[model samples]
Target: MRPADLAGVDVLILDRPPGGIAAFDLLETARAGGARLLCDVSDRDHDFEARIAALGLEAARDQANALHLAAVERRAVLALADAILLADPAPDAVLRALGKPLLPVTTPADLKAVLQGGERI
Candidate 1:
């Protein structure tokens, strides 16, 4: 996949690789898959933003009120997206329960398989 395909994508993938890649890798892959990155932060306010900056990813602000809001918004974005990839490992229950086009964040192969087709992955 290529980042150019991300244009007009509504769904955002909060990709959390099993062994995390650099922030830029996440940004590039998500954009390539035709989705935005719904970064899930477990740290102090907007620390994830620093990572985004480090990676040089430009995106609109989507600060969630709470973790649940983050999850819901992520799901909402995915539901509307051509694709959505799960990157956040915590709250596996939330991510898995939402059921809005998901791929395990554990491996690149899983993500590639899922993105190959919107369904049946």
Candidate 2:
């Protein structure tokens, strides 16, 4: 569905910006009707750097590019989101430092804990 169609949606599970799309591009339209963002931030800049170092820069070149884009997009999404789903603890620090308001939904256990705690997000 188009971003506009997602307005007022209960959840928008974005894995990596849609084909040929950037996360920032859909922000305004996607949230226009007030939808909760379940953004997936699988990696951060630091994590990418670590991957590159481990596998060698040349081997991880593609990941570097993806990370650069993710850093820009994820930060923007987090700023406007009701909650965030990520895999890295480093992102916690990034979020805290930016003072962005978002609930971190990392693993299934974490999501379960949130539901159990009555923190619907």
* Pairs of residues at least 3 apart in sequence or in different chains that clash in candidate 1: 2-32, 11-77, 11-81, 14-87, 15-87, 16-87
TM-score of each: 0.32, 0.56
CA lDDT scores, all candidates in order: 0.43, 0.58
Backbone clashes, candidate 2: 0
Question: How many pairs of residues collide in model 1?
Answer: 6
**Candidate with the greatest lDDT versus the true structure:** 2
Q: Per-residue lDDT for 1-121 in model 2, tens only?
A: 6566665665565664332244555665666766555656565442344546776767778567876555565566666665566566456466566554345676788766654554566
> CA lDDT of 61 in candidate 2?
81
Best TM-score goes to which candidate? 2
- Model 1 worst lDDT window (10 residues): 39-48
